[model samples]
Target: MGKIIISENVTLDGVVEDPTGDEGSVSWFTRIGDADRAAWAEVEHEEAVGAAALLMGRRTHAYFLHRGWASRTDEWADRLRALPKYVVSSSAVADAGWGEATVLAGDVVKEVAKLKEEVTGEIVVYGSGKLVPALLEHDLADELRLMIYPFVVGTGARLFPETSAVKPARLIGARPVGTALALLTYELVHP
Candidate 1:
Protein backbone atom coordinates (compact mmCIF):
# COMPACT_ATOMS: atom_id res chain seq x y z
CA MET A 1 0.00 0.00 0.00
CA GLY A 2 1.13 3.55 -0.61
CA LYS A 3 1.99 5.87 2.24
CA ILE A 4 -0.13 8.90 3.00
CA ILE A 5 2.07 11.85 3.84
CA ILE A 6 1.15 15.31 5.06
CA SER A 7 3.47 18.16 4.07
CA GLU A 8 2.43 21.30 5.83
CA ASN A 9 3.82 24.77 6.60
CA VAL A 10 3.06 25.77 10.13
CA THR A 11 3.86 28.68 12.41
CA LEU A 12 5.78 28.46 15.67
CA ASP A 13 2.44 28.37 17.44
CA GLY A 14 1.12 25.76 14.97
CA VAL A 15 -1.13 27.95 12.84
CA VAL A 16 -1.49 26.75 9.26
CA GLU A 17 -4.04 29.09 7.79
CA ASP A 18 -3.45 31.56 4.95
CA PRO A 19 0.28 31.88 5.48
CA THR A 20 0.70 33.09 1.90
CA GLY A 21 -1.90 35.82 2.43
CA ASP A 22 -4.03 34.36 -0.33
CA GLU A 23 -6.73 33.03 1.97
CA GLY A 24 -7.34 35.69 4.63
CA SER A 25 -4.47 37.18 6.59
CA VAL A 26 -1.40 38.95 5.17
CA SER A 27 0.64 38.84 8.34
CA TRP A 28 2.35 35.57 7.55
CA PHE A 29 3.81 36.74 4.25
CA THR A 30 5.13 39.95 5.75
CA ARG A 31 6.80 38.18 8.63
CA ILE A 32 8.46 35.64 6.37
CA GLY A 33 12.09 36.78 6.29
CA ASP A 34 14.82 35.80 3.85
CA ALA A 35 15.64 32.83 6.04
CA ASP A 36 12.08 31.62 5.80
CA ARG A 37 12.24 31.76 1.99
CA ALA A 38 15.30 29.55 1.94
CA ALA A 39 13.63 27.07 4.27
CA TRP A 40 10.53 27.02 2.09
CA ALA A 41 12.53 26.26 -1.03
CA GLU A 42 14.07 23.22 0.61
CA VAL A 43 10.72 21.97 1.85
CA GLU A 44 9.05 22.50 -1.50
CA HIS A 45 11.68 20.59 -3.40
CA GLU A 46 11.52 17.72 -0.94
CA GLU A 47 7.75 17.44 -1.19
CA ALA A 48 7.68 17.88 -4.96
CA VAL A 49 9.86 14.87 -5.57
CA GLY A 50 8.58 12.65 -2.76
CA ALA A 51 4.90 12.80 -3.63
CA ALA A 52 3.41 10.72 -6.43
CA ALA A 53 -0.07 12.07 -6.03
CA LEU A 54 -1.58 15.12 -4.39
CA LEU A 55 -4.49 14.96 -1.99
CA MET A 56 -6.15 18.20 -0.95
CA GLY A 57 -9.17 19.60 0.84
CA ARG A 58 -11.70 21.86 -0.88
CA ARG A 59 -10.46 25.15 0.45
CA THR A 60 -6.85 24.35 -0.17
CA HIS A 61 -7.58 23.10 -3.64
CA ALA A 62 -9.42 26.25 -4.56
CA TYR A 63 -6.77 28.49 -3.11
CA PHE A 64 -3.91 26.69 -4.84
CA LEU A 65 -5.69 26.29 -8.16
CA HIS A 66 -6.21 30.00 -8.30
CA ARG A 67 -2.89 31.17 -6.98
CA GLY A 68 -0.04 28.70 -6.97
CA TRP A 69 -0.48 25.62 -9.14
CA ALA A 70 -2.50 27.08 -11.95
CA SER A 71 0.36 27.90 -14.25
CA ARG A 72 2.11 24.97 -15.82
CA THR A 73 5.53 26.64 -15.93
CA ASP A 74 5.71 27.86 -12.36
CA GLU A 75 8.31 26.38 -10.07
CA TRP A 76 7.06 23.02 -8.76
CA ALA A 77 4.10 23.64 -11.08
CA ASP A 78 4.95 20.83 -13.46
CA ARG A 79 5.01 18.25 -10.72
CA LEU A 80 1.74 19.49 -9.25
CA ARG A 81 0.06 19.80 -12.62
CA ALA A 82 1.17 16.38 -13.76
CA LEU A 83 0.35 14.46 -10.62
CA PRO A 84 -3.06 12.89 -10.07
CA LYS A 85 -5.08 14.94 -7.60
CA TYR A 86 -7.71 13.71 -5.21
CA VAL A 87 -9.82 16.36 -3.55
CA VAL A 88 -11.99 15.68 -0.52
CA SER A 89 -14.88 18.06 -0.49
CA SER A 90 -18.61 18.35 -0.24
CA SER A 91 -18.94 21.66 -2.01
CA ALA A 92 -16.20 21.81 -4.62
CA VAL A 93 -17.87 21.52 -7.99
CA ALA A 94 -15.19 22.26 -10.56
CA ASP A 95 -12.51 19.80 -11.45
CA ALA A 96 -8.87 20.77 -11.27
CA GLY A 97 -8.16 21.36 -14.95
CA TRP A 98 -4.75 19.72 -14.76
CA GLY A 99 -4.08 16.00 -14.75
CA GLU A 100 -6.64 13.53 -13.40
CA ALA A 101 -8.62 15.22 -10.66
CA THR A 102 -11.21 13.27 -8.71
CA VAL A 103 -13.52 14.25 -5.93
CA LEU A 104 -13.59 11.87 -2.99
CA ALA A 105 -17.13 12.20 -1.67
CA GLY A 106 -17.46 9.03 0.38
CA ASP A 107 -16.07 8.20 3.82
CA VAL A 108 -12.67 9.93 3.86
CA VAL A 109 -10.90 7.01 5.48
CA LYS A 110 -12.42 4.40 3.25
CA GLU A 111 -11.71 6.40 0.13
CA VAL A 112 -8.15 7.13 1.18
CA ALA A 113 -7.58 3.50 2.10
CA LYS A 114 -8.72 2.46 -1.33
CA LEU A 115 -6.42 5.01 -2.92
CA LYS A 116 -3.50 3.73 -0.89
CA GLU A 117 -4.15 0.22 -2.09
CA GLU A 118 -4.22 1.23 -5.74
CA VAL A 119 -1.42 3.77 -5.91
CA THR A 120 2.31 3.07 -6.14
CA GLY A 121 4.08 6.13 -4.72
CA GLU A 122 3.52 8.37 -1.74
CA ILE A 123 0.07 9.97 -1.53
CA VAL A 124 0.80 13.48 -0.28
CA VAL A 125 -1.43 16.00 1.41
CA TYR A 126 -0.39 19.65 1.48
CA GLY A 127 -2.03 22.41 3.49
CA SER A 128 -5.25 20.50 3.88
CA GLY A 129 -6.21 22.04 7.18
CA LYS A 130 -9.75 20.64 7.35
CA LEU A 131 -8.77 17.20 6.12
CA VAL A 132 -5.65 16.72 8.22
CA PRO A 133 -7.45 16.19 11.53
CA ALA A 134 -9.92 13.79 9.93
CA LEU A 135 -7.12 11.74 8.38
CA LEU A 136 -5.31 11.71 11.70
CA GLU A 137 -8.47 10.54 13.45
CA HIS A 138 -8.75 7.62 11.09
CA ASP A 139 -5.03 6.83 11.36
CA LEU A 140 -4.62 7.33 7.66
CA ALA A 141 -1.54 9.50 7.67
CA ASP A 142 1.72 7.56 7.69
CA GLU A 143 4.15 10.45 7.68
CA LEU A 144 4.17 14.08 8.63
CA ARG A 145 6.59 16.57 7.02
CA LEU A 146 6.30 19.88 8.72
CA MET A 147 8.16 23.10 7.90
CA ILE A 148 7.99 25.03 11.10
CA TYR A 149 8.23 28.78 10.46
CA PRO A 150 9.72 31.28 12.86
CA PHE A 151 6.89 33.71 13.52
CA VAL A 152 3.88 32.74 15.57
CA VAL A 153 0.47 33.74 14.37
CA GLY A 154 -1.52 34.56 17.48
CA THR A 155 -4.84 33.44 15.92
CA GLY A 156 -5.74 31.46 12.86
CA ALA A 157 -6.67 27.98 11.69
CA ARG A 158 -4.36 25.31 13.05
CA LEU A 159 -2.83 22.24 11.51
CA PHE A 160 -3.85 19.97 14.38
CA PRO A 161 -7.12 20.49 16.14
CA GLU A 162 -7.81 20.20 19.86
CA THR A 163 -10.32 17.38 19.34
CA SER A 164 -7.67 15.02 18.05
CA ALA A 165 -6.35 12.34 20.34
CA VAL A 166 -2.74 12.40 21.46
CA LYS A 167 -0.89 10.10 19.12
CA PRO A 168 2.76 9.40 19.49
CA ALA A 169 4.99 9.77 16.46
CA ARG A 170 8.60 8.83 16.00
CA LEU A 171 10.92 11.49 14.67
CA ILE A 172 12.43 10.22 11.48
CA GLY A 173 14.53 13.23 10.53
CA ALA A 174 15.14 16.92 11.12
CA ARG A 175 16.95 19.54 9.03
CA PRO A 176 17.55 23.11 10.06
CA VAL A 177 17.36 25.43 7.08
CA GLY A 178 17.66 29.21 6.66
CA THR A 179 17.62 30.89 10.08
CA ALA A 180 14.48 29.98 11.94
CA LEU A 181 12.82 27.17 10.02
CA ALA A 182 13.14 23.49 10.70
CA LEU A 183 12.09 20.71 8.38
CA LEU A 184 10.87 17.93 10.64
CA THR A 185 9.74 14.55 9.48
CA TYR A 186 7.79 12.17 11.70
CA GLU A 187 6.51 8.70 11.17
CA LEU A 188 3.20 7.88 12.79
CA VAL A 189 3.29 4.89 15.10
CA HIS A 190 0.21 2.76 15.06
CA PRO A 191 -0.77 1.44 18.44
Candidate 2:
Protein backbone atom coordinates (compact mmCIF):
# COMPACT_ATOMS: atom_id res chain seq x y z
CA MET A 1 0.00 0.00 0.00
CA GLY A 2 1.10 3.59 -0.65
CA LYS A 3 1.82 5.98 2.20
CA ILE A 4 -0.47 8.89 3.01
CA ILE A 5 1.60 11.88 4.08
CA ILE A 6 0.63 15.29 5.38
CA SER A 7 2.93 18.12 4.35
CA GLU A 8 1.99 21.25 6.28
CA ASN A 9 3.48 24.61 7.23
CA VAL A 10 2.98 25.31 10.90
CA THR A 11 4.07 27.85 13.48
CA LEU A 12 5.82 27.04 16.73
CA ASP A 13 2.46 27.22 18.51
CA GLY A 14 1.01 24.84 15.86
CA VAL A 15 -1.00 27.50 14.01
CA VAL A 16 -1.46 26.56 10.38
CA GLU A 17 -3.73 29.24 9.03
CA ASP A 18 -3.33 32.37 6.94
CA PRO A 19 0.46 32.44 7.16
CA THR A 20 0.48 34.72 4.11
CA GLY A 21 -1.55 37.42 5.86
CA ASP A 22 -4.38 36.67 3.47
CA GLU A 23 -7.13 38.00 5.71
CA GLY A 24 -6.61 35.62 8.60
CA SER A 25 -5.65 35.73 12.29
CA VAL A 26 -1.88 35.28 12.15
CA SER A 27 0.63 36.27 9.47
CA TRP A 28 3.26 33.58 9.02
CA PHE A 29 4.26 34.53 5.49
CA THR A 30 5.70 37.88 6.59
CA ARG A 31 7.64 36.17 9.36
CA ILE A 32 9.21 33.61 7.00
CA GLY A 33 11.29 36.22 5.13
CA ASP A 34 13.23 35.68 1.86
CA ALA A 35 15.66 33.03 3.10
CA ASP A 36 12.82 31.01 4.53
CA ARG A 37 10.93 31.19 1.23
CA ALA A 38 13.94 29.78 -0.59
CA ALA A 39 14.16 26.93 1.89
CA TRP A 40 10.45 26.20 1.56
CA ALA A 41 10.74 26.29 -2.21
CA GLU A 42 13.38 23.60 -2.07
CA VAL A 43 11.32 21.47 0.26
CA GLU A 44 8.16 21.85 -1.83
CA HIS A 45 10.02 21.01 -5.00
CA GLU A 46 11.27 17.77 -3.50
CA GLU A 47 7.89 16.86 -2.08
CA ALA A 48 6.02 17.69 -5.26
CA VAL A 49 8.35 15.53 -7.30
CA GLY A 50 7.87 12.53 -5.05
CA ALA A 51 4.13 12.74 -4.45
CA ALA A 52 1.84 10.92 -6.91
CA ALA A 53 -1.30 12.73 -5.84
CA LEU A 54 -2.35 15.75 -3.78
CA LEU A 55 -5.22 15.84 -1.30
CA MET A 56 -6.55 19.07 0.17
CA GLY A 57 -9.53 20.68 1.84
CA ARG A 58 -11.82 22.92 -0.18
CA ARG A 59 -10.32 26.21 0.97
CA THR A 60 -6.72 25.14 0.46
CA HIS A 61 -7.48 23.56 -2.89
CA ALA A 62 -9.24 26.68 -4.17
CA TYR A 63 -6.50 28.91 -2.81
CA PHE A 64 -3.65 27.14 -4.63
CA LEU A 65 -5.67 26.30 -7.73
CA HIS A 66 -6.51 29.98 -8.20
CA ARG A 67 -3.39 31.63 -6.87
CA GLY A 68 -0.08 29.89 -7.43
CA TRP A 69 -0.40 26.53 -9.15
CA ALA A 70 -2.97 27.50 -11.75
CA SER A 71 -0.53 28.45 -14.44
CA ARG A 72 1.50 25.68 -15.95
CA THR A 73 4.51 28.02 -16.44
CA ASP A 74 4.53 29.23 -12.84
CA GLU A 75 7.45 28.11 -10.68
CA TRP A 76 6.88 24.61 -9.30
CA ALA A 77 3.46 25.06 -10.85
CA ASP A 78 3.68 22.09 -13.15
CA ARG A 79 4.39 19.84 -10.21
CA LEU A 80 1.08 20.74 -8.57
CA ARG A 81 -0.97 21.09 -11.73
CA ALA A 82 0.10 17.75 -13.08
CA LEU A 83 -0.65 15.67 -10.01
CA PRO A 84 -4.08 14.14 -9.43
CA LYS A 85 -5.88 16.16 -6.73
CA TYR A 86 -8.67 15.19 -4.38
CA VAL A 87 -10.68 17.80 -2.49
CA VAL A 88 -12.83 17.09 0.55
CA SER A 89 -15.71 19.42 1.24
CA SER A 90 -19.35 19.20 2.08
CA SER A 91 -20.37 22.80 1.38
CA ALA A 92 -17.82 24.59 -0.75
CA VAL A 93 -17.83 24.06 -4.50
CA ALA A 94 -14.79 23.33 -6.63
CA ASP A 95 -13.57 25.34 -9.61
CA ALA A 96 -14.19 23.76 -12.96
CA GLY A 97 -10.97 25.13 -14.37
CA TRP A 98 -8.70 23.16 -12.08
CA GLY A 99 -7.76 20.05 -13.99
CA GLU A 100 -8.22 16.50 -12.73
CA ALA A 101 -9.83 17.36 -9.35
CA THR A 102 -12.19 14.83 -7.80
CA VAL A 103 -14.43 15.79 -4.88
CA LEU A 104 -14.45 13.25 -2.07
CA ALA A 105 -18.14 12.95 -1.16
CA GLY A 106 -18.53 9.68 0.75
CA ASP A 107 -16.80 8.35 3.85
CA VAL A 108 -13.40 10.10 3.95
CA VAL A 109 -11.47 7.18 5.38
CA LYS A 110 -12.82 4.60 2.96
CA GLU A 111 -12.31 6.93 0.00
CA VAL A 112 -8.75 7.65 1.11
CA ALA A 113 -7.99 3.98 1.61
CA LYS A 114 -9.27 3.30 -1.90
CA LEU A 115 -7.08 6.08 -3.24
CA LYS A 116 -4.03 4.74 -1.42
CA GLU A 117 -4.48 1.35 -3.01
CA GLU A 118 -4.69 2.88 -6.49
CA VAL A 119 -1.75 5.27 -6.12
CA THR A 120 1.79 4.02 -6.66
CA GLY A 121 3.69 6.99 -5.16
CA GLU A 122 3.26 9.03 -1.98
CA ILE A 123 -0.22 10.46 -1.41
CA VAL A 124 0.36 13.99 -0.11
CA VAL A 125 -2.06 16.11 1.87
CA TYR A 126 -1.31 19.84 2.04
CA GLY A 127 -2.89 22.43 4.37
CA SER A 128 -5.98 20.33 5.02
CA GLY A 129 -6.65 21.27 8.67
CA LYS A 130 -10.12 19.73 8.82
CA LEU A 131 -9.07 16.59 7.01
CA VAL A 132 -5.89 15.87 9.00
CA PRO A 133 -7.60 14.97 12.30
CA ALA A 134 -10.04 12.72 10.50
CA LEU A 135 -7.15 11.02 8.73
CA LEU A 136 -5.38 10.53 12.05
CA GLU A 137 -8.52 9.30 13.81
CA HIS A 138 -9.06 6.71 11.12
CA ASP A 139 -5.39 5.70 11.29
CA LEU A 140 -5.07 6.43 7.59
CA ALA A 141 -2.07 8.71 7.61
CA ASP A 142 1.20 6.85 7.26
CA GLU A 143 3.55 9.80 7.64
CA LEU A 144 3.66 13.50 8.52
CA ARG A 145 6.15 15.98 7.12
CA LEU A 146 5.88 19.25 8.98
CA MET A 147 7.65 22.46 8.04
CA ILE A 148 7.84 24.04 11.48
CA TYR A 149 8.52 27.76 11.59
CA PRO A 150 10.15 29.26 14.70
CA PHE A 151 7.62 32.05 15.30
CA VAL A 152 4.57 31.39 17.45
CA VAL A 153 1.06 32.45 16.53
CA GLY A 154 -1.12 32.15 19.61
CA THR A 155 -4.42 32.15 17.70
CA GLY A 156 -5.19 30.43 14.42
CA ALA A 157 -6.01 26.99 13.06
CA ARG A 158 -3.76 24.42 14.65
CA LEU A 159 -1.89 21.67 12.86
CA PHE A 160 -2.98 18.93 15.26
CA PRO A 161 -6.34 19.20 16.94
CA GLU A 162 -6.97 17.63 20.34
CA THR A 163 -8.10 14.03 20.06
CA SER A 164 -9.95 12.01 22.71
CA ALA A 165 -7.84 8.95 22.01
CA VAL A 166 -4.09 8.80 21.64
CA LYS A 167 -2.67 7.77 18.28
CA PRO A 168 0.97 6.78 18.56
CA ALA A 169 3.57 8.12 16.18
CA ARG A 170 7.34 7.86 15.88
CA LEU A 171 9.73 10.59 14.90
CA ILE A 172 11.65 9.40 11.91
CA GLY A 173 13.79 12.40 10.97
CA ALA A 174 14.43 16.14 11.38
CA ARG A 175 16.29 18.58 9.15
CA PRO A 176 16.86 22.27 9.76
CA VAL A 177 16.12 24.40 6.76
CA GLY A 178 17.76 27.81 7.04
CA THR A 179 17.36 29.35 10.53
CA ALA A 180 13.62 29.62 11.03
CA LEU A 181 12.20 26.40 9.56
CA ALA A 182 12.75 22.76 10.45
CA LEU A 183 11.43 19.79 8.50
CA LEU A 184 10.15 17.13 10.88
CA THR A 185 9.06 13.73 9.65
CA TYR A 186 7.01 11.30 11.73
CA GLU A 187 5.64 7.86 10.98
CA LEU A 188 2.37 6.65 12.48
CA VAL A 189 2.78 3.53 14.62
CA HIS A 190 -0.08 1.17 13.97
CA PRO A 191 -1.21 -1.02 16.85
User: Quick one: how many clashes does candidate 2 have?
Assistant: 1
| 83-158: candidate 2 lDDT, tens digit per residue | 8888887755555555678888788888888988988889899887789999988888999898988887788878
Top candidate (lDDT): 2
The residue pairs that clash in candidate 2, if any, are 19-29
The global Cα lDDT (0 to 1) of model 1 is 0.81
Q: How much is 145 displaced in model 1, in angstroms?
A: 0.7
Report the Cα lDDT for candidate 2: 0.83
TM-score of every candidate relative to the true structure: 0.90, 0.92
* Model 1 Cα shift for residue 133 (angstroms): 0.5
Candidate 1: residue 137 Cα off by (Å): 0.7
Query: Could you give me the TM-score of model 2 versus the true structure?
Result: 0.92
